[model samples]
Target: MSQTNIPLLSLKNISKQFFGSTVLENINFDLYPGEVHAIFGQNGAGKSTLIQIVTGDIQPSSGKIILNNEELKIHSVHKARELGISAVFQEFSLVPQLTVEENLFLGSNNTKGFFLDKKKLHQMACQTMEQLEFSIKPEEKIINLSHAEKRMVEIAKAFHTKPSIMVLDEPTASLAENETNQLFSMIEILKKEGIGVIYITHRMKEIYKISNRITILQDGHVVNTDSVSNINEQKLVELATGRNITNLFPEIKKQRGKKLLDIKNLHISNSFIEDVSINVKAGEVIGITGLAGSGKSAIGRACFGVNKIEAGTISYLDDVIFDSSKQINDISPRAMLDRGMLYLPSDRRAEGLIMEQNIRENISLPSLGLPKFSNGFIVNRKIEKDIVEKIGE
Candidate 1:
């Protein structure tokens, strides 16, 4: 094949609208074989919308999608998969109750007769796991797997399709550094096999490391597309945000105050945390770093009332929030929030926000029952709108 040949996948003049509002406009993108094409943008920059159109989850209002120089009319996800396109979205679609093998071949049409060939399925699943360097067992249930393990299974499932074009949206958001390296290695193997990978991520470092070409999107339009070497990180950020980001991280010089939170001899039953002690001062920032299964996240959960503290003393600014020595009931999450202690869960979609609710509803959820936003049991529309707008700002 010549370098001047048709692209493996070409999106020409793609535009999408929702309820008369343009979400994507005249977007032209291409994915070439054996190359990793990265799509970069800020939040609501139409990155997900563009990906949905490609995966047949949403149809574009105007444009043509060419696959191997032929215009393709992708009506559904099944059709896209059948036409050698596969995607591993950020939110995994695995059935938690199903085994790894079952989830891997759940929607596949490769079985013979009415009965499922367990032996064949196991063999194929094992082969795919081996190819992707995944370490989970085929018989393991997804519910019992860790976040990183589930992410690996999702990737393995997508790779098992043997698609010529692959789309990975924020694949490493939940993965650790070592796990991310493993995924990058797998991407290299795919590239060698002439698979065109469309990688979407907000991390700037990964783009330079894994992508051959970069496409920046701003306000539902393609700002620029160029070779990785042709654009520096600063220039790339500027293009995506449409502004000169001179200092991405400004210097902070603030004096610390008295201890605000004090955790003493903390222990979570049947978990990794044991006899841990920590203190946080007001106006101070702290970071927790450890291996994937470490008790770092557990500490946050315990402090936020998500995990029970079997033995500990949690004092907030001289006030005893939780004292395991006392025979009292555990504090609820609502109580902690009412005390002005909010915990932002790592899994935003599942715990932090309601996915089905709109932005206004999500923002007002915490204060729904408050007197300022609700009269008796009815919500004050003006107050709710004002609260959302203030929080959004």
Candidate 2:
């Protein structure tokens, strides 16, 4: 499709439902050549459902999906890819057992009829990684890579598909600023190649920075679609939330309470972090700000037992406490949770959420074993739904 002609992809009056509850209602949208289109919405607003339908992961109950003026029969995800559609899901779909090169060339590896062509696959993988300026060995196993490295590998894998349309679901959630910039550069490269991109994110700054157009979804319906130039940040937030987006960090209403957390001389090996010290007072909102690799997140992990600390002492007031002599590394995630410390990871889909689980289970998972529900060792089901409904709102 020409840049000035009809859109490369179009969706007219799309709708979806589950068990009589409508998730997406009469939604319409379009994607044009060389344009970065963004879809913004809160959780459960059908943004995922729309992506699923477009990528053939799910079928829409009603609507017409036209690509290049031809109606598409998106029966399955594999079928979508066959039609030059690719998605880097919010959830990591990578097979960690495989090498980075193998993950990159999973299905499209050059094969000699019945046999596999390993050499050509590795060559193509290396070339693609080099193009992204990602420093990682093609032969390295995915389990050996850090979170950022794994995210980079996923992007490399997406590129190997040679897609006409690529959907990135929160691509920058785990990426550093430099890595995000690199991805943006790659997106520009794709745009020049006439490929359409659908970027899904909650970060308004990203929509302002990279997207050419924006489509906002709320309560499973389309609110509006317009050029980025036509709307400002406040307007965009209103569209996404149906209300003015409040300052996420609100003012303190009361005096800071007793010290709830304290860390002294924290360090992690080989990572760009060392000798970090911080404290969190009861009912206090503490913000950690720094450039990537500056130990901002590493500190969070060390406190929650996700990463090992070479030396540190954490005192969580009377509720919980830790000493450097004890192996904080030995502290289990359950132990941390038991002590009233919960972590909301930056990568919500990959680390913070279980997409396969329904909305109810995910919200209730943290408190699953609590004594509130107990009848012959089986938890009461009624209370679970109540808890979920409260959180879902």
Instruction: Give TM per candidate.
Output: 0.91, 0.85
Best by TM-score: 1
The sequence of per-residue lDDT tens digits that candidate 2 reaches over residues 171-231 is 8876778778877888888788788999999888888888999999999999999988898
lDDT of 2 at 186: 80
lDDT of 1 by residue, 50-100 (tens): 999999998999999999899988999989998899999988799999999
Please give the distance, in angstroms, between residue 343's alpha carbon in candidate 2 and its true position after superposition: 2.6
lDDT of 1: 0.89
lDDT of 2: 0.82
Provide the overall lDDT of each model, using Cα atoms, as 2-decimal numbers.
0.89, 0.82
The list of candidate 2 runs beyond 4 A from truth reads 130-135, 244-254, 267-274, 290-294, 305-310, 318-320, 325-335, 346-393
TM-score of 2: 0.85
* Candidate 2, run of 10 with poorest lDDT: 319-328
Question: What lDDT does candidate 1 reach at residue 315?
Answer: 86
Error of 1 at 262 (Å): 2.4
